[model samples]
Target: MSPVAGTVLAVLLSLVSAAGYALAAVAQARLAASAAPAGRGALRALLARGQWWWAVGLNAAGALAHVAALHYGPLTLVQPLGALTLVAALPLGAYCARRRVTRTEWRGALLTLGGLVGLVAMTGPAEPGEALSLREALIVAAATGLLIAALASGRVPRRRGDTGTRGLGHATASGIASGVGSALTQTLTAALALELPGREPVWWQTALLAVLISGFAVGGLLLSQAAYRGGLAAPLAVVNLSNPAAAAIIGVALLGETFRAGTWGWPIAAAASLVAARGVVLLTKGGAPAPEADPASSTVVVTGSRPVPPPRATELPAPLPAPLSTPLPLTVPLSVPEVEPARASIPG
Candidate 1:
């Protein structure tokens, strides 16, 4: 295929992938909203739902498309396009969840996407590098696990109105897990592709890598499911931005990749990151306004334009002493001589 044709194919596949992911996110968000709260039984409940399975299927399709896109085009070109997932998710989520996309949310989504795309564009193409050794992989995996636990542990109790914060934490963890999974996948692929004479690929090492990959992937998926329960746009934006950023960091640290613009790129990347963070903050702020208490159920009621506090227990009048069951007899008796005295005086 010509370069142009391959590039076109890659772009198209990336778009398809983005659309699939966006749809899946919406489906998951809907399911999470209705699903039981996160616990030991939550995963089982999610699995029982047909909609959740549909979301999984969609995600699988997206992953396959993403791999195909990578096959057709360079990472530099394809990775930036993946940011379109957030772009697609915003409207799709709004439509699917029956929520309005606010101006702040739109701005947040755009900022996140722009910053992420800028970050990816600044990254230079990766050169061939040594596959991560088992020891290195284990270390990375252990560290990632710790980070995930920290993020997902909910060590600090959340308020009823803090679902957005909870979701953001979970989404961030999900992104890290996913990014690590991708890095491991790349390592495994590189290891398999190595053509060293007289040395067979170690079976145990390959098995370990596969296991690690699966673990991270499953972990990421569950965290993402938890994330969507809060709301859609903010969590989705966070996940999309964090995923590539995490992967890029790993790529630079372990995969021998570097920034395209060298020394100057750091500041630009930092600025972009700040912009993206600001966007995420805006999106989070826009999360379904902490659900208003039902007026009917509230102690305060609105009369015309003013809120009236319910009558307090102290404000109620004391009940009159219970009515007497029967009338009481008179206690004092009258004297009988008064009439006789009057009569005697008249006769005299």
Candidate 2:
């Protein structure tokens, strides 16, 4: 395809992918209401649910579509386009849950939209960088491993009284993993491009790249859901913000792509990113937990990513009182003579 056609195709594919992601997020949120605790048992229960399955399928489709888009267009261009998911999620949430979109959500969405516009406009043409080297991949792996360890350490936040603080931490940590996963997509695209000729060595390399990308993507998915269950707006913003940035960096570093950031480009991009981050914060603030929210179970009710509480015990009602004894007939048989009036009548 020509450059114009390729770019258009990439844009269209990215949009469809965004829609899929929105639907998946909605499905996951509903399943969360009945989702088991986060563990082997919960995973099993999650898999058993149709909504959960739908989410997996939709996200997988989105990922595949995303990779295809990257294969054709610049990562910087395509990555930022993924931000469409946030905007799409708003209406999807309303339709699926039959709830109204809050003003805070709209404000956040608007901010995200504006930030995306600025980010995309500021992005310059990308140069095709060299494919990811083995050393670089290893470095990425080590860094991500450490990040996961720190996030999972269960260290309490300094302000224990403030609810959602720890959850935000979890969201941030998981968002980083998502960013790495986005980078992996760019790497995969490069590897796939090298494999078109079908040489034996290239085939092996491509296979390796595929495995790596799959691993990271799955890991990202797990972390992302965890982040969602842990916190919504914070994690949502974190993922949306970091994922593209990470991909852009990878495109420049590993894929031989150039962003051509000039004297003003860096500042513009930075400002736009900050705007997007602020918008995400607003989205979360607007969707604050209810006053009577159970720190754990309430997560299942509204916060999409936060951990879902196990199915509440089915409440059985109390038994009803026994029926009153049956009443006797008004008329009595002569031989039965139930009343004392018979004795008085014989004496008279």
Candidate 3:
């Protein structure tokens, strides 16, 4: 296939993959209302949800598509384009979860999209380099470990007063983890490449990859769920931006990939990042996302096929009339009149 054709194919697949992710996000968000904290209990709750499983399946599909896109396209192109998932998520949330997106939210989403486009346009071709080395992998792993520890220690405690803050914390944590996960995934992919030809993967290497993938995927997902509990806009934006940002950094550091700086390139990328951040703030300002309706709150009086309705209000009977202070006048005499009886009148 021609280079143009390959790129087109990659772009299409990436968009499709983004769509899948959007759908999955909506599904997971719907289930977020019921989600427990991140741990064995949360894991159990997440596993019990059919929506969670469906979301997982969708996520898997998206990942497969994403990996394929990365195989064909430059990371510069594909990584940034992944932000499209955040924009796509709004409409999917509206459709799948029936959440309404306000005008401000839409504008924010559009701004994010616009910023991503600018960022992409400003980015030039990436420089190529050698395969990932063990030293670089160890460094990445160590950094990831440190980041995870900070995140877990710093933000795991939930704040009743500022759930948003808690959520942002979770989102940041999840994003960093996901970024590391992205690197790990790329590394794993590289490992598999060796197996593609005549080389057989060593058992130890396979086990390590398996463990990393499981930890990254599961850990990132649980944290993501925690993030969503706070709301969509902030955390979602963090995730959308962080994934690519982290991956780009890792790619540059490990892969020796360099960006070709054009006249306005750096400026545009920085400005675009600002615009994306502004859009995320706008999304949070619009309104807190309404939680999925509780079935327990629904009433029989509900008329339609829509999701659960607000609890039905019942009217209380009017208070009984207070007792009269004074006694009312009686229509009849208070006592019956007594009649005199004749002594022997009835004998005859």
Candidate 4:
């Protein structure tokens, strides 16, 4: 296909991928909100929900589209486009979940997407590098596992009222695991295709990569489910940003990739990262725990069309005088006058 045609195909596929991801995120968020709290049986409960299954299917479709996009376009072009997932998710959440998208959330999502796209765009493409050796893969996997454990070990915030701090942590961990999984997937694919220089594919290494990939994929999914319980926008932003950021770091460290703008690019990336962090803070602020009702405050009773406030302390009727502790003295004189002798005398 011509370059233009291929680019167009890549863009379209990327858009489709974004849409799928956004829909899945909305579904998962709704499930997390409505389903029973996370526990030992949480996964089982999620599995029982048809919505969760639909989410999983959508995610799989998105992943496939992402891969196809990569096939048709350069990573520099395609990876930045992945940020559109967040853009798509905001409206989908508002519409699908019947949740209002606050202005803060919209601004945060945009900032995150802009920062992430900018960050990834600064990463120039590197020549294809050799796949990870078993030792390298093990090292990466171990490090990633440690990071995920640390992030996931924190106490989860309450599902009903929280600032999403714990959810953000979980989301970060999920992103890392997923990013590493993607990296491993690439390595495995290269090995399977015999793209590694001067080396025949090793069966054990391939098997190990597959195992690692599966482990990370499952781990990320579970973490993401937990993360959404706090709310959608902030945690989703964290996950989306962290996923690409982690992968880019891995690409640079292990895959011989470098920044496009060299020394100057680092500062720009840092600034973008700061902007993204600000955005996340804004999102979390937007999800501030709903104010608890004050018990001492006057209650408002809705009557007909208007709210009627309960009587103020001053307006309340005085309590009836307490009943007498002792019976009252007889109203009659204690010693009544003796009654006069009756009319017997007159009869006589």
The full ranking of all candidates by lDDT, starting with the best, is 4, 1, 3, 2
Instruction: Give me the runs in candidate 3 sitting further than 4 Å from their true place.
Output: 1-8, 35-40, 71-77, 96-99, 119-129, 154-166, 192-206, 262-265, 289-348
Residue 93's lDDT within candidate 3 is: 69
Q: Across residues 1-348, which tens digit of lDDT does each residue of candidate 1 receive?
A: 999999999999999999999999989888877838565877787788899899999999999999999999998888888889888888887777577888888898889888888888877756655556666677899999999999888642356666655578899999999999987887788667763122545988778889999999999998998888778888888888888888888778876778888998888888889988988888877765767686555676566767665665765554334333323432223334666788889968
Candidate 4 yields a Cα-based lDDT of: 0.83
For each candidate in the order shown, give its overall lDDT on alpha carbons: 0.82, 0.66, 0.69, 0.83
TM-scores vs. true structure, each candidate: 0.83, 0.68, 0.70, 0.83
For lDDT, the strongest prediction is: 4
lDDT of 2 at 133: 57
Ten consecutive residues with minimal summed lDDT in candidate 4? 318-327
User: After TM-score superposition, what is the CA distance of residue 209 in candidate 3 from its true location, in Å?
Assistant: 4.1
Evaluate candidate 3 by giving its C-alpha RMSD to the native, one decimal. 10.3
Off by over 4 Å in 2: 1-10, 68-78, 120-126, 152-170, 173-175, 185-208, 230-234, 251-261, 293-348
Q: For model 3, what is the alpha-carbon lDDT of residue 244? A: 61
- Alpha-carbon deviation at 78 in model 1, angstroms: 1.2
